[model samples]
Target: MIQSTDEGLMRLALREAAKGLGRTSPNPAVGAVLAKNGIILATGYHQKAGQPHAEIEVLKALSDYPSAKGSSLYVTLEPCSTYGRTPPCTLAIRDAGISRVIVGSIDPNPKHQGKGLAELRRDGIQVTTGVLDKECTRLNAGFNKWIISGRPWVIAKAAQSLDGRLTRPIGESSRLSNSHSIRMVHRLRATVDAILIGAETVRKDDPELTVRYGPTDHQPLRVVVTKTGMLPIDARVFVGEQDTIIYKDRSWSDVLDDLGRRSVTRLLVEGGGQILGQLFDNYLIDELWFFLTPRLVGGDKPTIGGVGVQELAGAPRLVDVRYLRLKDDLLIKGDLQWPKNPSRAF
Candidate 1:
């Protein structure tokens, strides 16, 4: 049973977990709170990959471990029971003399599922599960999806005019999003593990595709997919110091499989239409974010190219959709109900 105070503490833990979102790749952002008598002693969050997890950070923050012998620890996710880069957190919790362990969600990884809680119970520590479960689960939705599906969560993004045009009448590139929305796109780029674009976009937009609107210690990998290896050698994407990958004449599924093998948990596809169309045609995209500007650039170059579904029922539907006002543009975001692999439940 969880008290109201426990929910509040778990919410705080979730907030702490969010601080690591962009930096923690191949690992879920987890937060932990140590409390005694309903009062928080210390709070911590996972900072990056191959670093101390949330539970270890909370245990290390304690100035006097003996004084907080009966402290209760609240974590957004299950404490890891296996040794990887660091020792098992379950052992640390038991040695720390914590009396109760409340977890928001179980580890989605099949190997770690419920093992941490089971370990804690074996050591005589009181365990409570599923405190603020939905938020905790949603916080690491990309991680969970990757863990279960073995592929990165794909988010397709584009900036388009109200009339659904992606460029001018002559097929020249044009900026449709406002300055604020552009910064938002950059922020989105910073959060994902990689940014994917088509070669046509590279030739026309010539975007650097690096995070420029804000400060970031790491930049997402820039990936360009093309049938013909015809991009200019002097293109900014190739010239920049940041890492970039060129996939020539490869299947989209194969590209995704390779990305998954590289442990990319989140992938953002910013495109010039044909690529986005192929992804949509294959049901590879999981989420969508489109910035719609106030202006209408009437032309044959729409945001999406290719022969779309002939039947209305064949079209994919967006669920849990949201519209946000970004300066002069509207940011429409949602998840696609269709999955790349229909058998996989991501």
Candidate 2:
């Protein structure tokens, strides 16, 4: 185990690494920090694909530091030693005169994996692994999932009333989540590669569905699912110039396969209940974000419309549930553990 002080630096590196969540598809987000004499000299993270890796950026930031030799480097993922879109990060670190390296998680990409660490050691640099490793793994869940399973990690988000009603009435458009919770949902959208919704949601709410909470140059692609391809051109979803996709009666497998081929690492499903059910029916959802509002919409209201299971045992179960209070709203988050796919079980 690394010292607690070094572990703390690794945690900072991991946090910086997640800033590239939506931008770095087909590339694992990595963060690197250079420290000397118990002080962080500079920190950098992989911003997007087809660009320099974290170690190179950090080295460039620290190049002007006087007497920077023997500075230690802390990186969230193992540095790549082989060339691809950019030069090897290991070469940059060595040239920057970093003497020791600490890695939070080992890279599993086919090009590097264990070879990056081996290359660093061959160059007579000190190396330590597994510093804040669990958190680092969670940070790279989508990238790792896509690397192995060929499907983006799906997260389904729903906000319902205290009585589980998705809305007060069937035809009316009303917001169930508070302002705080709504922004939380938008932030989630900003972090994923795409946001999916059913045609009914667009027809009813006409939401802009753009990221308005934080500084973001890129927007998540908007995807609409419909039984037919017919949609109003004047709808609010089409008002913006962002890329949008419509799928007519496409199987969940087909949609997922297409996204995987595009290297989409993460997807967010903002549901109108039936869409969530459709994903569940196809066994595609991987995580669940259920928020319960403070108010109760109890009198003959539609509660989770069109969601059903033939038998009790068929319902998807939430494991590792964590509860928190967002203002007055109750937030429940967990892993959506589905039955294993028989064909892929082995």
RMSD of 1: 2.2
lDDT of 2 by residue, 1-346 (tens): 4766898888788877988878887888888888886698888888999988888778767758554579889999988899798988888878767889999888767768889899999999999999988778778888888888888899988888888767556666668888888878877787788888889888877777788887567788888889977688888778787878888899888887788787778888887778877677666788888889988887643434455656777666898898978898988988776655553311
Model 1 vs. true fold: TM: 0.93
Top candidate when judged by TM-score against the true structure: 1
Please give the distance, in angstroms, between residue 221's alpha carbon in candidate 1 and its true position after superposition. 0.8
Q: What ranges in model 1 sit over 4 Å off?
A: 169-174, 339-346
Which 10-residue window in model 2 sums to the lowest lDDT? 337-346
Query: TM-score of each candidate?
Result: 0.93, 0.91
In the range 45-82, model 1's lDDT, one tens digit per residue, is 99999999999898778887785589999999999999
Q: RMSD for all candidates, in order, please.
A: 2.2, 2.4
List the pairs of residues colliding in candidate 1: none
Query: Which regions of candidate 2 deviate over 4 angstroms?
Result: 63-67, 298-320, 339-346
Candidate maximizing lDDT: 1
State each model's CA lDDT, in order.
0.87, 0.81
Candidate 1 worst ten-residue window by lDDT: 337-346
